[model samples]
Target: MALTTALNAASVYGAMSRLANRAQSVQTQAGGSGESGGLDFGNMLRDQVKSVVAQGNASEAKQAGLMAGKADLVDVVTAVSETEVALDTMVSVRDRVISAYEEIMRMPI
Candidate 1:
């Protein structure tokens, strides 16, 4: 039937669209700039860690303001907590990368 054929075509199109979206997501996660090649993983990680540390510092300043009755305690706490989690994750990633580098260096050329 024509209805069945149309439905199949629609289903195929939908699947293709989903696949394209997934590919784009993967590319973005891999640090590819739109139309540009992939970014260096170490550089990307370093930049992210630096940004997270800056956020953490800002959160600390906000917390200090809360203590001085300038900002809300709840907002300050949430910011600080999120920053703490980011910093912890950054530190863990750095440790893993360093360990991998050391292991690689230990291998005979």
Candidate 2:
């Protein structure tokens, strides 16, 4: 049920599309060219996810080194903590985005 709700509340793309359209209009007006300088949300999202995956891999390597008695405990702790923080931040952002989407959907257009 929760999964369905989350899936139904996926309005972030709509919001991003509106924003991108606005940016494109402004760029076309200011630059007097057909090209829009706005960034792609899909690419940005993918890049951020890749960065988190890289951090997670680094953290895993640190833990492995620690187990081998070749790495400092401090470094291992830092890497794990950083990964946890990043995950927490991403989760928080996701929740907020979902909430915003739900709110927008509730609005009468």
Q: Local distance difference test, per candidate?
A: 0.65, 0.64
TM-scores for candidates 1 onward, in order? 0.58, 0.65
lDDT of 1 at 37: 62
Residues 28-73, candidate 1: write the lDDT tens digits: 8977654446665644654564567467567767866977999998
Candidate 1's C-alpha runs over 4 A off are: 1-36
Which residue ranges in model 2 land beyond 4 Å of their true spot?
A: 1-36
Best model number under lDDT = 1
For residues 9-97, could you state the per-residue lDDT of candidate 2 as single tens digits? Answer: 23432343455466556756665544258865544654555555567668778877988999999998898778668756766876998
Compute the lDDT for candidate 2.
0.64
Q: Superpose all Cα atoms of candidate 1 onto the true structure and report the RMSD in Å to 1 decimal.
A: 20.3
Q: Give the TM-score of candidate 2.
A: 0.65
Q: Please report, as a residue range, the 10-residue window in candidate 2 with the lowest summed lDDT.
A: 5-14
Cand. 1 TM to true fold: 0.58
